[model samples]
Target: MIHSKRSDRNNISPQAGLLIWAIIFLVLATAVLNMPGYPSGLKPATFLKLPLEVPLTGLALLVLSGLAARLLAFFSTLAIGTVLFLRLADIGVQSAFQRRFNPYLDAKMIADGWNVLSGSIGTLTAASLIIATIAVFILVLLLLFTAQVRLADAKPPITGNLRLVFGSLAGVGLIFFTASQFDGMRQYASLQTPSYLTARLTLISKSMDDMRHFDQDLAARAEKTTDEYLFRGVAGRDIILIFIESYGRSAVEDSRYAPLIQPRLASVGDALTAKGFSAASGWTRSPTMGGLSWLAHGTFLSGLWVDNQARYDRLMISDWPSLNSMFRDSGWRTAAVMPAITMAWPEAEYYGYDQIFAAADLGYKGKTFNWVTMPDQYTLSAFDRLVRHPAAEADKPVMAEIALISSHAPWTPVPRLIDWLDVGNGEIFDRQAESGDPPGVVWADDQRIRRQYIQTIDYSLHTVGDYVAKFGDDAVFVVLGDHQPAPLVTGPDASRDVPIHIISRDRNLVRRFEAEGFSPGMIPAEDAANPPMDSMRGKLIRIFSQAQ
Candidate 1:
């Protein structure tokens, strides 16, 4: 009798085991369905609300059985995983670019992100991180799949009238969601996973519509007239258009940075004045902020708002003549010194450059400063050696676009200004690149990151100022910022306006820019003309091509 009683106590019914598994599945599904889409939404209140998708999924599982039930479970799990992944992507993109991710247009950003990651922290470590992330995502899918399958196999006793409860909850959720779409009921609405997915779908549809309109605009631009006398006013002088990476107005306006940067700008201006150079500064709004610099470049060169990858790609294939091509047409040798382009650039054909100096062609033999290929000083020195000082193109009058990347992200070990005569082959910067704490160590602290950003901007300013002071004999220098730094360095509400300065020895050339609302000194006034980046291509051609 005692043995039989012990056996009965130790063994439990299969129904009880199934009921326990059902409860586990419910908890897991609830947790996933309650996940937030943005970092700011990560609060206890976010999880306290229920997701309508959970109840609807549970109801479907209860109504179906056998193959039908398993198939429903599989697709539901996939949908949940997709929504979760998009939420995470949105969080990451918002942190870097101050915007949400658009899967329709931003798919290329994945490859771009990989390149930046590998460049920041060796290729091997980046590969390992990618593998680990994939592994974690697969593990999550498998767990969700297992829990769903077990719940679908539950019997009547285990389910215990759950179908009725799930149906009632789903019905109420649908009504509330529909009502929330109305103006009067919006205040009562709360964010849920299903609503987030619906919103994403709406965004995708809008992006597609925007692309169509953009294509129409591109067609209209291709039909515009091209001035025969473009760049005719500055025909004899060499034109150097320099784009300073991440050199936004915040460097000269933010309280955290202006104290250190304004004085440096003033000193650089004084030094240039002593060398008989005049500078005119003003603000211009960039189409993009915090990375994807090609967008800003395309906007400036194409004379159209190329804010997304789709627009940029379309502009490349369109009949629009780039600013470089326009200069080349007007009897000036065109060149591009892009140190950041380490791979094949088929788009260079569209830019119409007679000579292209990529990273490999610059002949830099120094250590890289994390992601930055070489210092601004080296880029400027190399440009002078290859394009300016060379006697081969002395009479041609060159127009070149040199990209200075020293102020780019992962700003560390900012290189100091060395004498131009001493900057031979860039070997002098190796020690400075290797001396400071690595990117990982510095980026861990927000204060350190801000400080480093300001320092690098100061270094870049000095490099450009000193280079022009030493090299501006008969050349016109157009220096501007590509875009603002990432949101991590600048606060979330920062503007997308960047400062542009035109420097030259000819006071007449300076007066032309001032006529377009540029200030007299290095600092742009708060009330100066703030044009959109796309307007510069047309405004510049019109300004410099006029009879003077």
Candidate 2:
């Protein structure tokens, strides 16, 4: 009788341990199910879940309660944790890019971002994050190896049978409940895990399909290309296209910065008016956001919606007829003044520019403002000396794309506009560069960040206005933003719309874009139906290339 009693006690003990482990696992699984970043609103309550797998996992543990079960439990925990972490990362990447993260497509961008990681995350913070991540991973590994998993320990036959029966009941109840509320539960994930794995697989397949279709379309466009030039109307006029960095519509339209920014904008308008230059402003939806200025540049120039890096690479390699190519073909000297491009740009040849002025090529010996290679005032000064002045002396018509990047992220130590004549070699503004607050100090608070952003933008506008006041007599200038500021600056729900302005001495030049919905005098009118950035290439070509 004592032997039977002891046997019963042993059976109950193991069963009790198994039940406790099952409850803990269910709670953990439920927490994961109710986790954030599940398509914005599909996360269900923890208690409302039908976790059939929770009991099943317990049953498996109880059945295999040896070293093997312990290893299995450890690996399972590791795998689930890794997946949840990846889901969170995917959501972050999506917030930046409007699409889901594709490892194949985004891996290169990630590597490229590492080059500027210091400007992004401070060195100490990055090191700490790396160390913390490694420590957590090692800790998880050690715990899994050492954790006592006694769920599968041998028990009485009745105890084992009871576990199986209980698991069976849970599984059956889960199915019945799910079926009864099948329609309502459609939005809820059964296991509480997100569909990130399935979405990733789908993204891979879709990427392949898109590449094939893009190649076919590019080939068709290549075959249809002609050498006919239609730029006779503005043939001998100098045209300048300046892409301002991170100058989105939110700066001018959103309430946060609009009030602070509008007065400066109006001041610029007044300055331009004082210089006898008429200006029109409007909005264009950019293809990419935050950091991909090149994508917006490619889209604007090529008249193609170059949204992703893969598409941009393909567009660069293809013999695409762009604004520069058309201008070059029509007896105009085409050049690109890219102060941000510090390295070799073989793509300049593909874009059909006769000359390319990169960061090193621009004669500026000033201190770098973090990522901004040269100040806008210096860039304009160099452009005037190298391109505009020379072209004017030689009586050569010029078409150039100037990428002005002084207002880029980490907007620190912004150069104050000195006298235009004193901007020679860009050395006179060295004092101003040293005077402004450091990016680290400026970015410590949100209010300071916004203040610096506003100041930098005002500097860019004043620089442009100064350029026009000095050089507006001989050219038509199209100045616009490359893309919106990062989400941290613009908030999460910011639009991709960027402000574009056209300043010219010729009323006809400004009037041509009126039909296209551009408002007169610097501030773009509120137009809900503004065209995309890609459409500007065709519109400009149509308006300027007409028979006069």
**Top candidate when judged by TM-score against the true structure:** 1
Error of 1 at 479 (Å): 0.9
Clashing pairs in 1: none
Candidates in order, TM-scores: namely 0.90, 0.83
lDDT string, candidate 1, 188-238, tens digits: 223366667788889999989998998888777553334666677887889
- Model 1, 500: alpha-carbon shift in Å? 1.2
**Off by more than 4 A, model 1:** 1-28, 121-125, 161-195, 223-228, 527-529
TM-score of 2: 0.83
Residue pairs of candidate 2 with colliding backbone atoms: 65-152
lDDT per residue (tens digit) for residues 1-548 in model 2: 99999898777565566556555565664554344553453445534555454556556666675677877777666655655565555655655554456765676686555444455445565467667766865654444333225444536764466477657856775776567575654433255333545666688789878887887777777522233547665768899999988888888887878887788889888988887888888999999777778899899999988877888888888877888888887777888999989877777777898888999988898778777888998998898888877644755688999999889867887668787767777667677768776666777787877777767887898888878877878588899998888766787678899989988887777887776788988888876456899999988888786665
